[model samples]
Target: METSDQNAAVDALKDPEAFSVIIDRYRYQLSRYIQRLGAFDSDTTKDLLQESFIKVYLNLNDYKPSLSFSSWIYRITHNEVMMHFRYMRNRAQAFASEDALTLFESIPDELDIAVESDARLRSMHIAKALQRLKPEYREILVLRFFEGKSYDEISDILEMAPGTVATYIARGKMALGKVLQEMNITSV
Candidate 1:
């Protein structure tokens, strides 16, 4: 991620393209986070990323300018994502429930690996594996994978104990690996 200097903050809020630079900087990092959670809405994920940057831009005036930009931005993104999930669940009569939406959107992202040759095939394997996971397991995986946050950070975000976070991440990963094995696809 580009260091959020004072000037960059100003530019980002004022110009959409300027915000793109911030996205370009954190795109992979954040996507990895989202992908872990079984989220694969390319546009929505990107929208969340952009929203994080926009919040940063809009709230630059409130920033103390003494904290790490990484933590600040990620904290916002985390909250936003949670709210997004909740919002989609209750609002808009398109889906039966959040579970249904997760069933559809999250699978595609589960297999989004940065690999060479037969990417589509690998993605299929990935998606299949993800579908087998329980939601609790799935959520932890996505938090770690997409956000790249540490155990403590995740604990704080989820308001769970650190040990709980560890258990979830471990269980989720094991479940993912097992799912991959069942599909005869080597886990990435």
Candidate 2:
């Protein structure tokens, strides 16, 4: 695969289709990226995804070709998402504005609960047990089991040392297994 730096350099020249290629290449990954950042299929997430790409393109020239484009793009997406959250935090105080709010209120409460409960079925009994874990542990479990990404990939994505990633996965699995027993979920 071509590096983000290479893509960025091409995109920096304002090549008509180059930026679009980058978008096509990264859009699925970018969508998953936003989902992991806690955005759903609402207008807010949709707007954020659009804004993140524009931000990436506008700043493409600033990217050093030495870095992984994947990480760089993610960093941009991460920053934008975090910034949006920060803005919401500030705006949350100043306004009772329905216009600024996400459409989460449109979701049925029972539906959301059922969906969360269904998430328990993702990892089988073992995965169900893992749901009780802290966010950090749950993250490691999801990145490994649900996404099926490599340790190196998880290491790269999580920005953790490779060995640390391994240790966390091992421990997380053990923790999940323990939880499974407590929940009376038998491992096959």
Top candidate (lDDT): 1
How much lDDT does each candidate structure score?
Answer: 0.60, 0.58
Error of 2 at 114 (Å): 21
Roughly what TM-score does model 1 have, to 2 decimal places?
Answer: 0.56
Tens-digit per-residue lDDT, 1-85, candidate 1: 6445555667866775676666677667765564444444567767877776677667766655554556556666666676776
In model 1, which regions exceed 4 Å deviation? 1-24, 35-38, 58-68, 90-120, 143-148, 156-159, 181-188
What root-mean-square deviation over C-alphas does model 1 reach?
Answer: 7.4
**Cα lDDT of model 2 by residue, 44-162, tens digit:** 66788889989988887767655567766766876787688677762112112232132122212211122123332432333234336654565666566545557776776677888
For all predicted structures, in order, the TM-scores are 0.56, 0.55
Worst 10 residues of 1 by lDDT: 90-99
Can you tell me which runs of candidate 2 are displaced by over 4 Å?
1-5, 12-17, 36-39, 78-132, 175-188
